[model samples]
Target: MGIDPKTIDWDSLGFNLIETRSMYKATCKKDDSWSPGELIPFGNIELSPAAGVLNYGQGVFEGMKAYRTLKNRIVLFRPEMNAKRISMSTKRLCIPEMDEELFLKAAIEIVKDNVDYIPPYGKGSLYLRPVVWGTGPVLGVKPADEYTFIIFASPVGPYFKGNIKPLHLKVTHNFHRAAPKGIGNAKAIGNYSASLYPSSLAKKTGFDEVIYLNAGNEQLIEEVGSANMFIVKDNVLKTPRLAGSILPGVTRDSVLTLAKEKLDIEVQETDVLLDEVCSADEVFCTGTAVVVTPVGKITSEDGEHSINDGKIGIITHELRSLLLGIQREECEDTLNWLHPID
Candidate 1:
């Protein structure tokens, strides 16, 4: 057993760890297949001091959420997309790839075991973090002999504290979120480490997050530090094309589909220039954590640009409402994105 639900202040939940009942785990060797994992009680596990993850940073993780819906039911949104993405990350990191079926099964089992930790409907959702790490010792810069896969969770609130109010972001050409020919698209642990300093600096200066430009071309916008970015220009919804450097967010894909089908908006996936984003009619971001949030202000060397007069754009509001409605079972899940836990 873990912390009692009665003690959890659901209304005050944030994106911090609230230890749950158990976590799923599996192991494998470099040349072997992944073992059938089991749910282990939440606690620390021993690891080698010279582990590859500790030394060379060989790890990949995926972020997804489980929601308690309006029908008093538990569900996941587009989990298969997460499964596939994790698989890609593992392969890129040299970790023995785990089967997607096993991944989904393990995810289900972990959530069910920690069901009580899930916040109540409309309060917040349980944040799921599935990670694969190179656990074996490594001396030279090479793949480890063994690996570990774990799926843990926490009860959390909105990623950005201000709620639906638009975000104030800083554009930084000084740092790039990913390399065009590197592990930027793999969700590798190191990719995030590269952004900590810049992101923290931006936050200290009163900005919510920093937007990175493409490594090869500073003229092109890549993505927000931890989320995908989008711009609305002249009624066209546009986002940076996935050119192997940017993360292909599940929420990003869902938003694109919804814009075209539900809202009848033309969508464009291609090169998005820095000038284009700073001058767009509206800007927003999407991820498991942020869901959908508009960019109200963008601060760069040139100056501060206010989007839609520093308010959440109309299109941004509609998209967020439609997506949340489906997540909460309030509207028709026309896309069949939600997978009921039961």
Candidate 2:
């Protein structure tokens, strides 16, 4: 179905997929050389049942967005950072890395082609999902001889939906999102698979998301199901250090930088204990999808502990506003994070 932005109610949109006009695709051969990718119509392609991505889960992906500014310009936030991160993920997965320039080129082309699908400035934004997978059929466990890279976009509303109410999270001790020194830092497909059950359990128990802890001790706070966690105490912002098991999210980094530079807040990347979180003055999470969301309560075996009196902290509100302002071009782009889609 063709997407008509005029007919669609942008305000009612959700974080769901509505395939757009076209996507960009490229393939790599057995000799580890990549072909110049092309923009093609959106559809499924044939793949062998024994494809490496199916059998061995050899794949990596990235999530980003293009926003419509108040001035009617489309811009991407830190596309180069996504390019570099995806390249690193591909390398870790034994897939040939596409050059950063090529990655950006493909992203630009895909967003520009679907420009009309991008919602108006305040309504929503165009979300882009770029994926690379091993496509070659192989019986043995190894990297595929062939690989495919593709990027598709969908217009999505705010991930949390409705009013920006603070969320409630559960600290899950039964499951770990990633192990120590594993592929946790990479945006690999397998990492998310491990989080499904725990996250579902949290939801079933009436929690918004699951907060994962370090695998070994289950004492140190790692991250949430789909975002990075942060805590505030004594006027300082703290998040878990990137210890190879945590995904270094672009939005996480942006928040840290903004807190330090713009807000003049002291930011620390260190081991955040569960006890600290329980007693924190404020808590929040950041990601490409959710942006910045405040955590009002954390429920664990000990019981529920309300953060900042179960209200959004002043810093959380200000940081979210600043980030959104910069994204919509309502504030100065002093960080040079936005890449125009024109």
Candidate 3:
């Protein structure tokens, strides 16, 4: 009965203070070779005042999780996806490329070292964070000459607390998350920083989240601030196409794959029109943090439109269950998406 995982209330669980005493860290020089990766204490390290990340906002990070399955195995859902996305992020900011093999190894080792803190199958998960930052000290307006990669883990509960209900969204027309041919496609720190004000405004107006459509043209739905948007109509799953603006989420890809193979749903990845979304049967958002969120109602310039039953829809619930099954190691992993750590 010592901290029973199943009995632990995920909504009220906070970070436990037990130190893992281990972190995976490595440094890359100008020549692109990585220094020896080491497992060190989870403590702060000093950086130069003129660090490129401090001044130029040259930092990128990825959020992933490890779940203890019903089979008593620790598994990570689609970590390779995180590796690929972080590589793309490096390219976007002119940072040195990371060896995918090395990066993945570091991530896995960090989780393995802290496996005891990984909550039970359904209670919560061990949230994995892989961060890359420009480390060189430079006052000039150019790319940093060096960089550091670090991987850390912490136990986390469900991203959205309370019952898993459909969310309320406000269409943000006055702001844009990313411009065409801009850094919006990358998971950079600056992109999220720029969106804080608009997101705050949306929350103040009684909305659960904000969906930003393309600037000037309200017809094309780009994406939400932190997740990918999806609309269901007539048994079809539609999401915004990658038009050089949206972050391609790993959870979104997993849902599409599961829908096609398990649910037998027609998955469409294309340009979703804002007007068409108003008439969608149901809407949902996907991300690493929030596995899946049902959109209850959408508030736009015209008015609010109620989604399917103003609650979690049938298809949305089905998809969420299927995906969670795979993550929790309850279902047979037909797609081989889960990588077990022990």
Candidate 4:
């Protein structure tokens, strides 16, 4: 009549696990020595009402995944990269610098402990979220002295719920996601919270996602809400270079490497004008969750334009399959990007 994830057969792309448990947590003290991190049950967190994160929006986070490889082993895709990015976010938010090795250790432990939740070959994956935030009471406007770092795991399928249709996007020139010297690069909660309203408005208007451009000039593309953008034209891959404005996405980096070495394509990191992208043969977005998603059409106040026959282009699909092959352990990981969990 009913079944649990563990009860299902571990066939290709299926999620079947007997039991799920354990999480990693650590508390940061003002003394700079973090309390010994521990493995605990998956549960709720207790935070102070007046914490800096609540009042002043002082928090940051990162997203990663554990894949079920062909060898039936669990591996994380460049987790150290995510940890390093979190460190950068902390510095930007005035948070304490955490030991990267220790953080990686905790992350690995959490995924290994909850390995059963990892979906079968093509099913899905175990999504890991590492969150760091101000904790304890802090009524002042400055950063909080106390903090908490926690890692949690969940079995997730596709990022978008419905059919795997290429997204229809809207280029927004009015609202901007991040500012020149602001906290846009960081994976801070407030940055996403700020995007909710505008994104919701776009959805109501029939646009799948809103492509937020720079505030000053509507030329440079920053990022989608949860992913970064890329353009493929004449066998050349172009993405917005890391200005202080865009979030440095790990998947974006991976795709660039794959395009150059494996696919024998030229990749460029430069500022691309919105008009220039209109001429591109293909466009796609990349992130840890949505590995590579194509953009079929874009509508702006200026008017709508079709991107490469308004279909998922050949280059986008090829790159996505190659990357997913490595992630799912279906293909050779030549770059040694996957780290196996104990």
Candidate 5:
């Protein structure tokens, strides 16, 4: 199952699926115990038409990456966090929890089997997606009697095209991504489905993405289409607090930690008003896919407002560099975030 590097145009890789040599698959039986995962050929999976995941949306997934380090070592960044989040999401969705050790093992083994697909050190990294879904057919509105967990890898470049320039965002009051007290906190597949319409509208109107406000107030900023939003003003870093409506992103947490420990910057988590955000010094969003992306302008009903004079801010630049450095093993991982794949 060896992959030929020459077959891939690594430099032109996008955030699209390019299946690797193998993937990890584990199944949870009716007795609530998981089977030992094994590497299987990367391909389609058979499922029942009435599967709980197909009918009732009983699914949860985690996004992570395996990096090729400067010393030619493979590593994962803060995979434990992804495992914890996946467990929490499964609990909320009524699916069986995956063993953290087994989850980690699957991630490592899948990456090992697909090591040849790992993009060269500078081009990009291997994107790992771990998904758990109910496979048992259920006619009623109840949890499934069986489930399956799979981990797969794909080589991807930056999520957003172009250089590390600033991106434009559109704040929409016409749509809400999640409710105040709903499954928004979980990495559920349905949440993204709800966002497709608004996001498509925003993109069609010549904007990068859409910013969703709280469903309750529709004033307080919740998050972007697929990432967590942060605003910098008066030398303090502020982001929307996780009040059960926004997904607590891993990169968002990492940026907050780096701002406090490495840069000694003041960090705050609270409600971010649209009015205040329009006047902020800088704006950015974070996610596993994009990592950190600076916002250049926000288009609202009132008008378009430019952030940091329509350019990337110093804080955003430095933080992105710091995070990327740690990920690529170009800088010291003082927090011991990198878990080497052995």
Candidate 6:
């Protein structure tokens, strides 16, 4: 069971972990299939001192959220996409791939068991984190003999500290996000670990996040920290193509689709140059956590450039409003994106 709802101050909730009542867990051994997972009390589990995830950093994770919608129902936004992405991530990390059905099942189980922790209809959402780890002990630099999968839930408000104020981003010429043929496209835990240093340095300089450039091409942009980058110019929306370094974000895909089908905007996935972004009409980043955050200002080696006069642009606002409307079931599910849980 979860804590009393009266104990929670939903208005002041931030993007921090507040443990829920239950979680999902399953394990798989090398050369075997995954076990049928079950809902268990939410708590930390012991791991081997020489676990493969500890030594070699063999792990991957997925982020998702369940919303209490205006329709008085609990729902998830495009969870199937998350299932497919996590499957790809597991294969890249050499962990046993979980069946897509099992992945969806575990996600639902954890969220349902912790239903009480879900915030009220307009407050926030229950953020779900599904992680797969190389749990078995390993001596050499190789895949683990066993793997573990877990799903947990927490109620979170906004990803940004001050809410959705347009982000202040800086381009880092000193550090690149990932190599051309590396696991940059995968949701591996190691990939995020590599970003911590650069991102922290940017934050220390009064920026919200760092815009990573493609390691292979210095003039090209890769992503905004962990989110995908997009720039709008002359009424056309352009983002970096799905090269070897950029992670294909679910929110990015949705925005692209909605922009083309709904807004009638021309969408381009090409090599977006740094110079092009600095002069674009609007800039934004998208991800599961950020949803669609407009970029107010972009700072580079040259100087600071204000996007849309340090305000959210028309396209960005429409896309975010459309995205949230669908998530909250306030508008028609035109693309069948929402998955109802109740």
Worst 10-residue lDDT window for candidate 6 reads 156-165
Candidate 2, after superposition: displacement of residue 106 in Å?
A: 0.4
> Per-model C-alpha lDDT, please?
0.91, 0.91, 0.84, 0.82, 0.90, 0.91
Candidate 3 lDDT, 76-191, residue by residue in tens: 99899988998898888878877777878898898988777787767788888788899999899888888988887777876655688688999998899999888878889899
Ranked by lDDT, the better of candidates 1 and 5 is 1
Clashing pairs in 1: none
TM-scores, one per candidate:
0.98, 0.97, 0.94, 0.93, 0.97, 0.97
TM-score of 3: 0.94
Evaluate candidate 6 by giving its C-alpha RMSD to the native, one decimal.
1.3
Per-residue lDDT of model 4, residues 1-342, tens digit only: 112457544444322223347678998965485555998887777777898788888889998888887888888999889989888897788777667888899888888777767777666778788888888578767878888888877676656544568888888777899887788888888899989888998999999889989766777777876789999989899998887778899999999999999989999999888887777899999998778999989887778889988888888999998998998888999999999886
Query: Which residue pairs in model 2 clash with each other?
Result: none
| Candidate 1 stretches greater than 4 Å from native | 160-163
lDDT of 2 by residue, 135-241 (tens): 99999999989999999999998776657889999999788899998999999999999889999988997999999999976779999997999999998999999
Decide which is better by lDDT, 5 or 6. 6
Backbone collisions counted per model: 0, 0, 0, 7, 0, 0
- TM-score computed on alpha carbons, candidate 4: 0.93
Candidate 2 residue-wise lDDT at 244: 90
Any residue pairs clashing in model 4, and if so which? 5-16, 5-17, 6-17, 6-18, 13-121, 13-122, 13-123
Worst 10 residues of 1 by lDDT: 157-166
Which residue runs of candidate 3 sit more than 4 Å off their true CA positions? 1-11, 14-19
The list of candidate 4 runs beyond 4 A from truth reads: 1-20, 31-35, 160-163
Error of 5 at 232 (Å): 0.5
